[model samples]
Target: MDKLRKALSGRDNSDEQEEERGNIMTQTEDTPLLRVMDNSTLSWNTRVKGFAICFGVGFLFSFLGSVFLFLPNGITIFAVFYTIGNILGLGSTCFLMGPVSQCKRMFATTRIIATIIMFAALAMTLVSAFVLHNKALALIMVVIQFLAMTWYSLSYIPYARDAAKKCFGSCLDL
Candidate 1:
C-alpha cells in the first residue's frame, strides 16, 4: 500500500509539472490570430494580410507608375493621383498589420476570402502590367490595391471591436 501510494503521488506530480510547462509554452510567442485572440479580436489575420497585399501592390505599381510616367512627365496631375493612391494603399496596409498581429481567432472562410483577394490582386497586377500595356492599367492596379486596403481596414475594425466583447466568440477569454 505504501509503495503504491508513493507511485501515484509521483505520477500526479509529474503530470502537474507537464501541465505547467505547457502553459508556459503557450503564454510565450503567438500566431497572427493569437495576439488578437487575447484581446478577443479574431479577424486580424485577414485584415493584416489584406493590408499587406495592398501595400505590396501599391508599392510595386507606384514604382512602375513613377518609372514609366512620373519621371517622364515631371509630377503632373496624373502622377500626383498615382502617388496619392499608392500612399493611401501603403498606409492602409501598414495599419492592418497592427490588428493582424493581435488577432487570435481562426476562421476558414475569412482566410479563404483574404487569399482570394491576394491572388486576384496579384493576377490583376501582372495582367495589367503585361497585357494591357497602358497607363490605365497601372492606374487600375493602384486602385485595386487601394480598395483592398480599404476593405481590410473595414473588416478588421469591426472584428477587433466585436472581439473585445467576446473571446473567440465561444472559445478562450480575451
Candidate 2:
C-alpha cells in the first residue's frame, strides 16, 4: 500500500512538472492583451481538437449551403450558411495560433488588402441576402466572397499570388 501511494505521488509530481514545462514554452509578452492570450492558450492536444472540430463544422456548413443553392428561396439560406462557414473556417486558425497572432497575421501588410476585401465580401453577401433580398446580387456577392477568400488564402503561400497573376496573364495573352 505504501509503495503504491509513493508511486501515485510521483506520478502527480511528474504531471505537475510536465505542466510547468508546457507553460515555460509560451513566451509571455509585456502587453496586457498578449498576457491574457497567453494565459488562455490551450494544450497542444486541446488546440488540435478544437481546430479539427471548428474546421469540420465550417466545411459542413459550406457543404450544406451548397446543397441549399438548388432549392427555392435558397439563395438567402445559402448566403447565410456560406458566410457563417467562411467565418468559422477563418476563425479555426485561432485555435492553432492564438487569437492575437492570428489577427496579426491576417492584418499583416502582405495580406491586409485581401483580408479586408474578404471581410467586406462576407458582410456584403449577408447584406444582399437578408437586407436587399436580391438573389442575383447575393449570388454575385457570394462569388466575390469566394474570390476574395481564395486570394487571401493564397497570400499565406509565398509567391502564390504572383504565380497566379502570371498564369492568368499568360492565359489572357493566349
Number of the predicted model whose TM-score against the real structure is largest:
2
Candidate 2's TM-score reads 0.77
Tens digit per residue, CA lDDT, model 1, 1-174: 545433312325765587577754367787865654332232555555766777777667566656656455433334444555455464553343343332321124554464356446645655655566455765676567556544544454547536643654667643
How many clashing pairs per prediction, in order?
A: 7, 0
Per-residue lDDT of model 2, residues 1-174, tens digit only: 545433312325764577678654354545766554652446666876888999999989999999999998899999999999999999887777667667878999998988998999899999999999999999998999899888988987779999999999999998
Pairs in clash, predicted candidate 2: none
RMSD of each: 16.2, 10.3
Taking all chains together, each candidate's TM-score versus the true structure is: 0.35, 0.77
State in Å the error of residue 31, model 2: 14
| Model 2 misplacement above 4 A | 1-36
